[model samples]
Target: MDKDKSIDHQLRATWQAVAKMYNEQAANYGSTMAMAFVLLTIDKENGTPSTALGPLMGMEPTSLSRILKSMEDKGAISREKNPEDGRSVIIKLTAYGLEMRKFSKSHVYQFNNVVREYVTEKELDSFFKVTSTINKLIADKEIYNAISQDK
Candidate 1:
């Protein structure tokens, strides 16, 4: 099948383009798209658990750790012992981090607004449904299982 007609290829290509756009915006603030993502994922009023951050963002532990370390060094976030779980820590955003979160949120809203302008509501709804179905298929292991069963 042609790559242009492949669903996964289209998704991957669109995501890469979106990532590049976000990274360019983040660069002005001395940040990366990943860092902005982490900033947005963190809880504002209550801190998020360090252990939960990785799974929440679909990120690996090592990568999350490095980002957290950098955020700490930059005074964007601070780590404190989790009272509920001594073995884990809670990641809290500082004033600078809060400010950055706002910036990140604005960019996200702007992206959505721009897309909404071009895409109709029905089209956007269909897009969401399709993506959700794709996620559900993968999550259920239906794709691979069906392939294996066919053999």
Candidate 2:
């Protein structure tokens, strides 16, 4: 089978391209794509629990720790002891972080608008359906069990 016809190949290639473009654009604001993504995931008003951040953003603890530290050093976020949970910390956006988040939000909106301009609503619906099916398959462990059965 041709690699170009593979769904995994197409998905991986498309995502890599998207990440590169986003990182390039983020560089203009003195940020990286990951930083921008973390900023956007944070709640503007209320703080998010440090433990929940990893799962929420699908980031590894080590990687997220580095990003959080860098953001703190840059005055983008503040970590405070959780009032409700003594064992946990809350990640809050600094005033400057809110400003950066606004830009991140705008960038996301611009990307969506550009995609909408090129793709029809019907096409987006179909794309969503495919992605949803893929996610369901993974969540149900169909792919994992399928390979295990052949062993």
Candidate 3:
């Protein structure tokens, strides 16, 4: 099949481009896109549980651990024992982290604003609906399961 005609190819290519753009922007702040994502995922007022962060970001534990360590080294985040769950730790953003979060948020907003300028609201709504349906199909295992069951 031609890559240009493949749905997955389009999705992957667009995401790669978006990631590259974000990474370039993050480099200006001496950070990576992953770190910026974590900064955004974390709650500002109440720290998020370390365990929850992985699932929230759809990231693997090992990768998240490395990112967390780097953020800690940079004083962007601090870990504290979760009061509600003594077994788990909570990840809280320090003052510097909060500032970084703001910067991350602004970049995100700018990206969306630029996209909105080019795309109509109706087009964006359709794009979101299509993506949501794609996610649901994958999450429900309806794609491969159907093929395997037919065999």
Q: Give the candidate order by descending TM-score.
A: 1, 3, 2
Model 3: lDDT to the true structure: 0.98
| Best candidate according to TM-score | 1
Give per-residue CA lDDT, model 2, range 1-151, as digits (tens): 7889999999999999989988998899888899899999988889899999999999999999999998999899999999999999999999989998998889999999999999999999999999999999999999889999999
Q: Which residue ranges in model 2 land beyond 4 Å of their true spot?
A: 147-151
lDDT of 1 at 3: 100
User: Per-prediction TM-score, please?
Assistant: 0.98, 0.95, 0.97
Q: Return whichever of 2 and 3 wins on TM-score.
A: 3
The TM-score of predicted model 3 comes to 0.97
Q: RMSD of model 1, in Å?
A: 0.7
Give the range of the ten consecutive residues with the poorest summed lDDT in model 3. 79-88
lDDT by residue for model 3 over 108-150, one digit each (tens)?
A: 9999999999999999999999999999999999999999999
